[model samples]
Target: MQKRVKYFLIRLHYLTVNSNHERLHQDREIIYGKRGLRQYWEITTDKETISDDSTWLVMTKIPKINYKKVGKIYQIRAWVEYGFKQSKSELCWADFRVTNYAQIEKWWQLVMSAYLMVSLHSDSFNPMVTPVSEKFQQHDWWNERKGWKNILNNLRLIIKPYLSFNIISRWLKVFPIPQLSLGLPRLINLMNEFDCLRYFVYFWDNFYYSSA
Candidate 1:
């Protein structure tokens, strides 16, 4: 039996959506503009079910694009949103206090630079990269990880040594006398005595593994 839709004077009847990205319905409406005329699509997509939040309404000015394109656009939007959130939280991107448009633009450029830096490291660490990270790929824990935030974390770790060096060199006016503290060799001897070097790991151990 063929499905039926009942249209009334004031409203359109509900559509039975059956699959994701399936175009439940689409129509164009007049959008008057400076160019004299424009058209837009009022689109609905199926989310694979009728009872759930299974239908989505999408409005786009591009009337030529199909429902699948609309779905991909939204998916891309989700990825963009995720990247923006990462910029804010991980890359120290912040709201601009300067009201000048030029300053705002400069801040945007700096933020984008930081974002690109993190993205480079993140891409390198991604298991799905064209050339996999062969060193850690075999570890079960490495592949089953949750998010790329760890890449930013490892980056922070990498910068920490330089930061410590900078602070100690420039800011420390009083230095610890070599006689007062155990030297690195003595410390290593103590470590060997306690047998703790293998267990006590570097910051990258948290970034990836104890060694690599």
Candidate 2:
């Protein structure tokens, strides 16, 4: 009973849907500016550094709370991806949760290694591209927009991917791609692209292709 209550409270705190009529302007301000893409930092939680220092460019995209029970701890990785001719350095923050901080650090190290390893090829590692605005515009329901804002507003909070298999299968019906042959590792990499969905679209298309 206690566990159930705890779970309910956590879920409520995590996914509460609030009416924005009073805060419409405020929500709009949050949705379109630096306030829209909120970022936060914490010194420690459960003996872990919950957020990176401000000296670096830090961003986190968390999933949902309910999904965490399945061992899908939300993750974020921060590292220096580019360098400039100045004393200050540039860093990128990515959200992806693992069960423990060890995995978090490992993933962060992987990206750092990738950045350094790829530096031999180019001065920058540009493996991922931000989805085009047109893609988002097509799915522009008010709630969808609100959800996007929620993601941006709590970028640092840990969350499990909010999507489900049924949700994914439905999206697959829309695309007519013949096949996607991505092996497991590439699939994981694709999932890392977005905190939610975590490459949900990519997963659907690839899975659709694989089935074909």
Candidate 3:
């Protein structure tokens, strides 16, 4: 049935649907049945060339009058899928083991923010040239034009050393300490050794008092 419809449309030579420079010939038909069944538009694109063997089909609740927008929506959907794929695979978005809904939501927010940060940072560099120093040239992952995943991985390696106990301790001195004897390293080490509940309590205490 589908092949017959496609052949009929091809014979008719339907008007071209312009979607981002790709000229697609589209034909839409409305299918109607019982009152309980909702109406839908069955849209099919004619094959572009003899080499292209398949016809693209889209079924939508949207009216036939808005068929041009459907092509654009599909183009945008591809980009959205690409972003999700990169986030999950490259950014390790599926690595979390949390059972709480709130915790999972927060993790997704952080992962998206991190992904956006890497994307923005990569865009700042010239695509034709390497953004790193000569020292990074010897590394296997280093390239003339680094993708978002490579940029993010390299950024993690570059920032890891600066997040050490010594660096964090120095930075924490700016905050007014309640106990001078309780150094940042000792306090941080204690927090590291704490169980999940203790850590949660400590975090909430700091958060509540900090806001006050």
TM-score for each predicted model, relative to the true structure: 0.44, 0.18, 0.42
- For candidate 3, lDDT tens digit of each residue in 25-102? 454444443322333333445434423333445455554435456555654544788866966677677777899999
Model 3 TM-score relative to the real fold:
0.42
lDDT by residue (93-186, candidate 1, tens digit) is: 5554778988877777777676655554443443222333344344343442435565555445435445554555433447764542334335
User: Model 3 lDDT vs. the true structure?
Assistant: 0.50
Where is the poorest 10-residue window by lDDT in model 3? 3-12
In model 2, the Cα lDDT at residue 166 comes to 35
Off by over 4 Å in 3: 1-65, 76-83, 124-143, 163-212
How many residue pairs clash (N, CA or C atoms closer than 3 angstroms) in each of the candidate models, in the order given? Answer: 0, 11, 0
> All predictions: root-mean-square deviation over Cα?
13.9, 22.4, 13.9
Stretches of candidate 2 exceeding 4 Å from the true structure? 1-91, 94-99, 123-212
> Cα lDDT for residue 181, model 1?
38
Error of 1 at 105 (Å): 1.7
Best by TM-score, which number? 1
Model 1 TM-score on a 0 to 1 scale: 0.44
